[model samples]
Target chain A: EVKLLQSTDVTGGTFTLLLIGMIGTAVLLFLGTGWVSRKWKLPVALAGIVAMLAAAYYWQAREVWLTAGQMPVIYRYIDWLITVPIQVLALYFFIGTVARPPTGLFWRLLVVAIVMILARYMGEVGFMHPTLGFLIGIVGWLYILGEVYFGKLGEINTKSASETVQTGFFWLRLVVTIGWAIYPLCYFIGSFAGGVDEGTLSIVYNLADFINQILFGLIILYAAAKESATAR
Target chain B: EVKLLQSTDVTGGTFTLLLIGMIGTAVLLFLGTGWVSRKWKLPVALAGIVAMLAAAYYWQAREVWLTAGQMPVIYRYIDWLITVPIQVLALYFFIGTVARPPTGLFWRLLVVAIVMILARYMGEVGFMHPTLGFLIGIVGWLYILGEVYFGKLGEINTKSASETVQTGFFWLRLVVTIGWAIYPLCYFIGSFAGGVDEGTLSIVYNLADFINQILFGLIILYAAAKESATAR
Candidate 1:
């Protein structure tokens, strides 16, 4: 008899967690936007849209995983391709709340973010040599880190007068540097390490995504809420 | 070899339609709430929440059906038990904009809507005799129709001065009367028809829900927008 999942199933359990993470975060971010002033609402609502987009993908991914008993790699990448870029762009908008960053910074970060996700996707799906794809993806990520931490974006953050914006920038940069490390680490292990199964990789990916997407958005929301409070 | 679904699959196609219906409706309703006056925002948001709630359940149902190749009966019922009652309660609040529905009317409609869903659920799952369960379910639905159409709620609608509300009331009542008939019709056929396949029944039900939930909300949103426009 075919069954969607048993209560004790491990992978199914992780899928449930991601589903909850996406939906819960979306609701909180949407509701949270209402409390903040108009200037900060866009960033907070952008965070919410990220969660909602991920939630839709997770629905399809859950179906794919449960029925096929296989990793839903394509769905995950499709989600990342759209959401990750928006997330990168969200940093641009988040900074805009305090002072306008150069418009060039916006397009630069967008391009880099898309390249990062695309390179990794190509590697995972065999469009390029895995090592080449991995290396390109790493370069794209490091470029973002440099741009946000030590490049023009970083310079703007240091000059911003709002302590709330400064604090938000510090944490956002840290997330890009540290929280994002899990993706490459998992990719290296899955591609280069011998004998790692798909199920383990899938679960780890789900957990990483839960941290990556939801936590990233929550940080933006916290900053927005704080900025709004201080202004009043 | 198990597969989630092929591109040309009919049941899978219907599932896709329902997924799109729920998510699309939720987004539209949420966005539409912004253009409306503050007084009408609550009702619009409620409609969005109904769609959002159904979207979550549809994710599970899609997984269950794709994996198990079964009807996903329980998921659908669980969804109905929550959302159908909320839709009924939404009517109470919708009418509240032009006139306060009797508090008793709210409680009565809620109770009856729940009974209608639960009775059908019990019969479908074999927890009660099919014929008796169907009869009770029909009675519950008919009672709701009478109350909304010819009883105290109907009385309030007729007395309301707003043309927008009157038109909305007409469409909303028509949905309850006509749009909702598919559920019992499907139930009766599934229980009594000797040769109906589960796949056909599932597709039909999905289409009905697309009508019942999304169309029902759209009618309300249209009226609310109209009311807002007229007031301005």
Candidate 2:
């Protein structure tokens, strides 16, 4: 009998709080982008959004800010936190591509948006079906690789020093994409073909999840750094 | 105690055969697109790839071709069937976008490519986390709606004289996305509010799955029609 494992009460509560914090941060960033875009400029505003999301993710993980299962009211909001921003960013990119926006922040924001969304969603759901999540990771990396290979990444631009500069995060994007790609390949092949035991599967899944979350955090950091450097 | 649903030892030989037949037909249509492109002088080859993937998905759910436990295998191949063509199309589109291929197939193909990939993976993995899959569906549809609103759909050249060119069985996309969205919404609200019953959850899950599969089959039919139309 395959007994369904009930999600831990503590984890569920923590999940809720993390989600609420993430969503609240996303909303603040969205508004901040609008204000900052009108004042300091768009690149700086976009950078702010990336920085805020990254900070929210870090805060969610911090023991000081978050206690396990202490808040159940926030998980539903967290789920949206992980999903809505990605969709918004992707849509923004798609529309930009068609409309030919003056600033090429579209694709960069699209990738960052997707990475953040996936990181948060994976935090919530990746453990549920490790194999499938691994597969999706491969697919996501491949999609990003295709974009980079085709020079689509260059289409995105940053407003720096009153000039539209092409400050694409080549190395950071490459590392993050490669990291996600390899992590999944290792786990899926190890478990599916090697016939690794369940214990190993669990370990690998948690490790991969942790690594993915870290990479996501790093990607955001790189995006902010790249933005600031370009501004200089 | 949640007893495991005992699966009958039904010979899935027929289902397997049907799946192969569908794959074979889809492959042929996929290949047929290449030949048609050459004959029609369509500036790009992605149209064929799209045709092929749509065919595979639409044919995937032939009632005669699936059974219990057989789904995972059927879905695995189906995933490849849809994914490979989309990736190829995306690569070509990326090249076109950067290289300035005479045809404007990049944006439209990109949309279809990503959506196809998402649909394939979501169908396979969404079963485990019904809520997550539903959320993906809503996000995807909203993205598509954004595209439609931006007139991106109209830009896709169906390569046929017909005004109403069917693109895969988007109905499956509609059903799965809508169904999954409803499931998660219900689960989150009910789980949090503590008002929904298990029986309701089970019924919603089963119904969504059934609708998703049925729509999948319909998509295959649409793919076939698309092939025939374009072939003419």
Candidate 3:
């Protein structure tokens, strides 16, 4: 029985570490892309502040997980704080690219930031399942996909009369969108299949989450490199 | 023991009825608001559709509660479905009003529709702990308050070169916001002071919820009257 318990602890610890790593890598990718965008005169640089905070949140959450034997209750609080910036930046990028006479990156980011702040409460109060943390992360991926689809990928050229959409990231966008979509559907289905066993559903959800995050990280890296090269 | 069981049945039956009524009201409010927005050249009529479906989900969830008699099991689903629409519409209305601009009637009716939705969800899920529902409901109320504060509370004249914000509904917005805010805080404090018995928490929460719905319905009626007078 002691051996079994130790093994269980090991598994839980590893799983927690993996989730922390995914969140950290996602934050880095966001900052990296924003850096490239800033170099190109796009307003993405301002949104990078959100990315930095998210990285810090993941770092704290991971530390808590490593030290605390029980799930750190405060991890939820950190989860919420991190979600705010990501949501804001994601929506900012979306609206900035779509605006006919686009407003400054400020308004778009502000709106998204507020929405995310509100969403944080929803998650914190247990209004939605904590697993939603991973789900909300997909918004970042969606923004990237939207930018690529609309050919607004990379730095802005104010001197140019009109902006054109880029096609290089089409396949990358397709893969990410499809992958993120699957995570939610799997979650909904898993909820029913797992029934009253919260542990079972959490395991299934986390495994799918691990796969999704790794793929997401790869996509971000690919897009960042592609956009950087195009800039050169 | 038999009398106690009878009391339980009676309360459960009443809860079910109230839940149905709240959902019915939500659907009507959603449809009515959609019709009005469409006529006003606002493209957010689809958001109204999504909101209505979410209300329907709440409706079904309440039915499950009435039948299942197992609060934990039924509530898990109810909480999930309700949160989606609340979050979705919260973001939708914020962006919609900012983007398309709407008349005073839109904000008023939206508050009503959202309150109705909140009442039903609270009745079913938060009935046992009204403070939770009340706290969640306040988030929605604040969004409307923010709208009014930002001056998105008036009619849009499509032909005009620029739109103007109106503040005629200032008092109405204030009353609704304050009233909703009080429910959660009051109930929470009351529950703590009175001692945290399950039955007591349920009663306080349910009573606060009923008051919220009644206030919401009144706002809708007021909005409808204002809209008619303005049209004439």
Interface RMSD of 2: 16.5
Candidate 2 global CA lDDT score: 0.39
Candidate of highest DockQ: 1
Worst 10 residues of 1 chain A by lDDT: A71-80
Q: What's the CA error at residue B100 for candidate 3, in Å?
A: 5.4
Which regions of candidate 3 deviate over 4 angstroms? A1-232, B1-10, B37-172, B194-200, B207-232
- Per residue, candidate 1 scores C-alpha lDDT tens digits across B1-232 of 4454543355755675466557756875786687678878888888889998988877767767877887656678888899999999888888889878788888989999898889877887789987888898899999989988888778889999988888998998988888899888887777687658888888888888877888888888889877887787
TM-score, candidate 3, is 0.36
lDDT, candidate 2, A102-189, per-residue tens: 3554555465546643653464464446555545545655655555444344344332232222222444355446545545554456
Q: Evaluate model 2: give its TM-score.
A: 0.29
**In candidate 1, how many clashes are counted?**
0
Per-model C-alpha lDDT, please? 0.80, 0.39, 0.41
For model 3, name the residue pairs that clash: A151-A165, A151-A166, B130-B205
Error of 2 at A213 (Å): 21
Residue-level lDDT for A156 in candidate 1:
80
lDDT per residue for candidate 3 within A27-82, as digits (tens), equals 33443453344432232332333333444544454345445533433443454355
- Which pairs clash inside model 1? none
Give model 2's docking category: incorrect
lDDT of 1 by residue, A1-232 (tens): 4456777678877887788889999999988878887667667776787788788777767766777777645556656766787788788888777677888888888898988877776666566777888898899999888888887778888888888789888888888887789888887787678657888888888877777788889989998898889889
DockQ of each: 0.07, 0.01, 0.01
The order of the candidates by TM-score, greatest first, is: 1, 3, 2
For residue A175, give model 3's deviation from the true position in Å: 6.8
